[model samples]
Target: MTTPETFADLQIHPAVLQAVTDVGYETPSPIQAATIPALMAGSDVVGLAQTGTGKTAAFAIPILSRIDTDNRQTQALVLAPTRELALQVAEAFSRYGAHLKVNVLPIYGGSSYVPQLAGLKRGAQVVVGTPGRVIDHLDKGSLDLSHLDYLVLDEADEMLQMGFAEDVERILADTPEYKQVALFSATMPPAIKKITAKYLHDPVEVTVKSKTQTAENITQRYFQVSYPRKMDALTRLLEVEEGDAMIVFVRTKQATEEVAEKLRARGFAAAAINGDIPQAVRERTISQLKDGTIDILVATDVAARGLDVERISHVVNFDIPHDPESYVHRIGRTGRAGRSGTALLFVTPRERHLLASIERVTRQKLVEGQLPSVEDVNAQRVEKFRDSITDALNAPGFDTFRQLVESYERDNDVPMADIAAALAVLSRDGAEFLMTEPPPEKKRERPDRPERERPARKVRDDLATYRIAVGKRHKVLPGAIVGAIANEGGLHRSDFGHIDIKVDHSLVELPARLPKEAWKKLENTRIQGILIDLKLERGGRSKSDKFDKGDKSERSGKFKPSGGKPFRPKQ
Candidate 1:
């Protein structure tokens, strides 16, 4: 078998070839080389490749080649798990199909429907959207897929993991049975295999092996800290680490903004990029990163897809990802183009299992790193301060400033060293040049109470119980609540405790020392389209009094329970 060296070797459409050339894609990735030909041959494809493996082009190229420009009906429909991925895939289609007269539209939630409806009315040849949004358009009859010839599921495993299996199935069912189906995923779990078995017709399976493990040319390390101390640990690390550019990956969009805000408050040049940011602003953020205006980018996984910045010298996993593949993808943003990169993962003590899983997947043992001590931070700060002074001494127009300083010293009868010291202090603007000493670790004494006699009514010392409005009546399951809270609060599964589901509400126990920001996020978050209405339980309140008799007016008007009735526990 002859391996194709270039995209043109696969006999791509002349227009597509031109677009690919314009985009500077000199050679196709292994997945693209293998899958594009198979797809262009009109065969169903199952592509197994990781996130950064160019899977979008693998399907987009062939889809663009086969699209009928004269027929404006939707010919290809791409389903992605998140709006970010959907927009990215749509952009790839538009970019790859630029030379060809093809219309591509991206329809996703969190955006107005007017443009999507108008695009569908204008007859886009390719439509990309999330499963739920796609279903909405289909039900409204705004998106006509009766003539759809191609269906592609990008990140199929993520879609399933996010509980989109039913939506995906329904969307697939709506498509023409004879239409070619292509499913691309990082991993082929049993669920994805089942989807392929049911929907694909003798699909051509193409697996692109990742050539490099995450550990290759990357210095991987982890810091074990309690949840409350993660922010302090991260800030300390950032102070001492050497990196021209860095990316900090958080789990939630809210965390991205919160972390970015905190970093900025500490006088760091940081920006947050998440799904909520407009496409134009996101592009500008990336551009600023590449051009050195921004040194730190705090982002979520979905928002950082396809981000390739040569200057990114470090990747910080501010929050451990849900899966090992996502960890790989996050760190892969750095250590590119034969450059060495540093990846620091912040793992709470309870999240050690996830850390172990990542190590197992990367096939490298991560070195447990310590937080930079106060002394270390002070030394670095002093060194940088001296360097700044040295640079200023050599800069142009320094003589005039020096003359003014000398005149002041002579007039005030102050020593030259004192003036220099005063100027240095002024330069720092009264900010602490050194970190305060970390508090001594305190040993907890065990309670004298007998283990068997411990009060059942009392909450566990390590667990804090909270009440939520959604429960079985709202079709809320324990797993659903856990998933929502964990994702929203940027918490690990172990961070939660027993979940008691009542008729109209649920009680969940989370880590007692959860940060105030995380608690606020959990309170404001929603599950199953209803606000969680989460509140810390007070002592001596009857369950009925807490749920049924709660004042509805106290809650935010933005979110309400399904019915006008207040939440009530089962009798």
Candidate 2:
């Protein structure tokens, strides 16, 4: 079969093709070129491709091309590993099907069920969700898969690694046997092979290997920034950067607008574009960007997919992407057509791992970027102010202002320098022309000393205790509990205190006051397919007493596997 060059050659729906054109994609990617035709022909597909290889569009375009928009039954189901990826995929489907009025819903844990239930009730043709939440909705009878035509398991390897294997199997069991399943994973492990062997029916395999290197024309760098200081850091960086035009990539639609609004308030000519924006408005925004009406454009990854503008000399990843493929795509927006460009990534302390992942995938180490100091910003402002004066002196106008300054100095017997300083202050409009020294960093207060140095038996009020329903019988380790909570609950290791595993349950100490987001995530957190059912233990036996009086049987360090085999611990 001849490889298709353009999206128009793929026989996609006109509406989807137009949307793709609006996004500036003229040619189909290798994955899309190969996988779309197979999916459209009613064949189960196994796409072996890395993230950021346009996998979403490969399946989404074909699904949209064949979807019956008139039938509101859930026709397609896409399962992703994380909430962020689910949301991203849902957004892509929505953007591509905007003209068709397709309803795409994203369901995930760590969020309220009210909206998802309502969306399902209203009948979204396409449903995207994490495995756990999808199972929750399915068991509740809110999600119906009887009419499912397509099922896509994206990042299957990552999902399996995150301990969603059993959940994935359960979901697959619920789907209709006749459904066309498309499984996309970077690496086909033994487990994934087992799944394919048992489930998929003579699937067509398509593989696309990305260049394991970043573009040579782009200079990559990153700044370690805290969440609260991101806006300040961005403004300072913009003030010092010498780029003609730049694009700031954020993770969500709301963030695109929020960042753009903040940038505009800081005197930048900025605009925002996301999937929610109308096609006409999006086109106008892109046109403005190209014609130099806007200098900084804040956009999401989907919104910036096919955008190619020569004026864009810089790309700022305001929110680090969830995967390395996305990082490559975000930076690729700049340094296009063999032009030299700069890409800046903002990595919060918690996102250092993601930064490392990008570095490993791109095979290029990113230089650490330093935030402009207060002195540096102040100096830039002073230099710009002096240049403005130089330009005014050379201009033909401003004669009246010059005469007034002279008259004021002569009449008041004041030095011309004092008059000029007073005028300069007025020109600043109540804002300081030079910044003051930054405030000192606040020290975190600890009671009695650090947790490590403190006595383990000490029960501090700052640490709250919680209980979970997995223990030695389940072969659950303290590290497992910590890993589950830290990854799913979004809690830091320091946020956890002591973990004491009992025969059937475990007790853990956490901060007394947890962030609202973390608290929500913990509510739905699971360990080895069992919901933790986390509940605060306000009145329990003292932890020290419980530790001193341990159960003899559990202390023997012996356990039985679910297969009824006695397991002995290493000495």
Candidate 3:
């Protein structure tokens, strides 16, 4: 694989070699150059490469080449640590095998099982699944791996941290002995090191180190915004960050398009780059970027390679790149040679762990950048607008424009101030650019229940109470109960009265003489996608049911019961 500079030098099928050329990859990265030959030789490999260094393709190409399409069995298995990473790796496989019509299935938690089971039934050759779900399928007799040819463990260290080690071993135990084993990780922790030592047979190791950024010319900085208002902070930063050109990186293609479209809509020239774009269009877009037709390029990791723009003055990760190596390559895009450049990274409350990783890699703490207010963007815009007007007034061609303005002033009898204000009006963005208002404050949450429960007001003396098995958090407005009764129970709205929502249950007023069939219908009806359950409400059952006391949920059904979680609907 290291014999020549191009991917064609590798001992791969001609079709795969041609596909690599079609994607415009002229040189192999370090990991690709080293690990690929060993894999193609049918030897096991454990690749130690950082994120964003073409690790996906390193194992992907070999797996695709070795898979036998005529054999209708699961020939390849790729296990990722997280669902997001699993989906991302499966997408890479699909994109690389677009001409091959290879069927790759990505199975993970969070999604339903029916579609996945269906894909498996259709004779998919490559099965990518999380460890826990993969183990579940193996136990269920659905995921047959007796015919597996290549087994890849991607991000092995992460899977162990997420507590998937037991499941990983169980799944690996079922693979055929002759299968080629490949493991890739950012770091070789003790656990993964042990697993590789036991399972791999004379595996060749390849490590690709990311070029350090502090050694380069880039100056890195970070700003800590509180949990609620990061969007406003990014907007304020973008206005001041503007220069000849820039590349803003987000986590996904949808985000790239969204942030880019918003920037363009706000009058800055911005465009997005991602893998979905056709090769011809992506090349043309990159060409336009170099020719000064585009001022800003918003992109994701895999799409922004081979970018060498002299005009790029800044790089913004609108969202933090997935790993520290990604962070280095992103900032490295700017600050070439001895040129000074700036990098602004955005992090959220939950992602502070990732920030810590970046600091460790760079060996320097990132200085926080101040969040700009609305006045900041307006001041910059007004300064530029005024400069533009001054330049036009001083131009050699100003005499003609001045004559036209003066002619209008004389003929229309308009005051000069009025004319100037009119001209400014046509240029202002809704005339509020100068009237700076701070971004809207997030809503302060009010306590859901009263500090002290009110004394039970008797709707019927010595009456029976029924539990609705739902609560305030379900958006169960009082009108829903009133209408459900009036429509289904053949009663007027006045037939029902006061309703109460407790920590996990609710109570509603109903006539004592309600019939059994109607009550059964009421109990079975699903209100807002939640099945209604009618039961006796006891004044002391809250204490008996351990309503806020234990880890056990009130309803433990087929899936893990989520008590009082917010409602999510299918799109």
Best by TM-score: 1
lDDT of candidate 1 over 23-45, digit per residue (tens): 89988999988999999899999
Whole-model lDDT for model 3 versus the true structure? 0.69
- Candidate 2 — worst ten consecutive residues by lDDT sum? 545-554
Once model 1 is optimally superposed onto the true structure by TM-score, how far is the C-alpha of residue 518 displaced, in angstroms? Answer: 14
Please report the TM-score between candidate 2 and the true structure: 0.69
How many pairs of residues collide in model 2? 0
lDDT of each: 0.78, 0.79, 0.69
Residue-wise C-alpha lDDT for candidate 2, range 45-90, written one tens digit per residue: 9999997778999999999999999999999999987665787899
Backbone collisions counted per model: 0, 0, 0
So what's the TM-score on candidate 1?
Answer: 0.78
Better of 2 and 3 by lDDT: 2
Ranking by TM-score: 1, 2, 3
Error of 2 at 94 (Å): 3.8
Q: Once model 1 is optimally superposed onto the true structure by TM-score, how far is the C-alpha of residue 408 displaced, in angstroms?
A: 3.6
Each candidate: RMSD to true structure?
11.5, 14.8, 16.0
Give me the displacement of residue 566 in model 2, in angstroms: 77
177 Cα displacement, candidate 3 (Å): 3.2
